[model samples]
Target: MLRAGEPGATGYREALEALCRAYWLPLYAYLRRRGCNCHQAEDYTQGFFARLFERQALVRADPTRGKFRSFLLAALKNFVADERDYAQASKRGGGARALPLDFGEAEARYALAPSDTLSPEEFFDRSWALAALQQAMAKLKAEYAEAGKEHLFERFKGSLQVDANVASYRDMAADVGMSAGAARVAVHRLRRRFRDLVRQEIAQTVSEPAEVDEEVNYLFAVLTASV
Candidate 1:
């Protein structure tokens, strides 16, 4: 985040893009929960980011305030309130270049959200947690694909957060043509790698290295509540 906060610094744009990509869905989810239709939500999410860059919001962020997630939600609240007249959503983003957000699939994902029991903020946090898990899982898959082990990763991925009994490792071994013991060992390695990736995802939003574990716990709690 500090890297993103400094414009023209080495890696600044990369850092900013990473932040944008990770949180865009959560922000869109927030808008949807706040009663915006899909089109309004997409336009608002795009406009918020455009305004963020225009005003140098990142450069002015103070890590002392709180986690990046909270800061972003607060910023979004302000943006939404200020743009209450966003019937003009068409005009707002028509002139600014947009971010590479996956608005196409965003509504499909939002359709699977829990029934309207959660507040907008609660929904945003839940989406954020899920999104983090997704990003980590994708990165893990990509690593295995690059190593020519996509089949192995896919076979054991369900074991990443489970115990030694990932349904039936013996069956997995038979399918993958490996010994049962080898499958168990492979699953153990996959679980270890997945935990590392999850931790890395948590570490991104926090101001201090020590905050990752607490953030991870909070993320799980949000997911648990939704379930």
Candidate 2:
């Protein structure tokens, strides 16, 4: 039922909402990394989403042009460039509105990696990928927790990151108190779940399901270049 290129149609609002939910964290991280203070970043992030509700912007979005993340980042860069001074302006009618933001978490994540060599576009894509992965992992962990396999999820999640010297299946199995076969199975399942989640994440922003692989490859390239 989720057709593309119909921003004013009955399902358009729902589709856009889903896209925002998937990308908000990455956009926030990009803003925070670009030297915006926590409050300014929060406002800008909220404002960016608010602008998407504009008929002009939504109706003009062309999925055929490529990845929605790219379109969004470009829009955000233009928005910031255009609104450079608005963040510091005094309010006329009342005190500044409180923009809802997860400042604590944003600050924590930013603090962990305060520097990067990637261009703004690359950084945005990298952040997008990370956010998508985080959301997918959270959902998977919750499912595991609900099924009384929280420990298993915890053990595997720790090793999801790519590393040149990653431990072997036998080593991880020993560390997690599971047999090598069981560890291998768990890791395989986790990888499959991660891939499915990534596809789902990409599908939300794209007009066509066939475009998922292309977006996924671009995401990997962005992450690689950023790192």
Number of the predicted model whose TM-score against the real structure is largest: 1
Residue 124 C-alpha lDDT in model 1? 96
lDDT over C-alpha atoms for residue 92 of model 2: 17
Scored by CA lDDT, what does every candidate get?
Answer: 0.81, 0.69
lDDT of 1: 0.81
Residue range 124-216, candidate 1, lDDT tens digits: 999999988999899999999999999999878877666656548888999899999999888888888888998887777777778888899
lDDT tens readout by residue for model 2, 1-227: 13434655677766766667667777877887777777777777766666665644544455446667777787777666656665332221012332345657877876675375766556677778888777787788888899998887777775577421335777778877988888888888887887788678777666677888888888888777777
- Per-residue error at 132 for model 1, in Å? 0.2
lDDT measured at residue 132 in model 2 versus the true structure, 0 to 100? 77
**Model 2 spans > 4 angstroms off:** 1-5, 63-65, 81-84, 87-99, 158-179
Candidate 1 deviant stretches above 4 angstroms = 5-8, 58-65, 88-95
In model 1, how large is the Cα lDDT of residue 185? 89
- For all candidates, the clash counts are 0, 0
lDDT of 2: 0.69
RMSD to the hidden true structure, all candidates:
2.3, 3.8
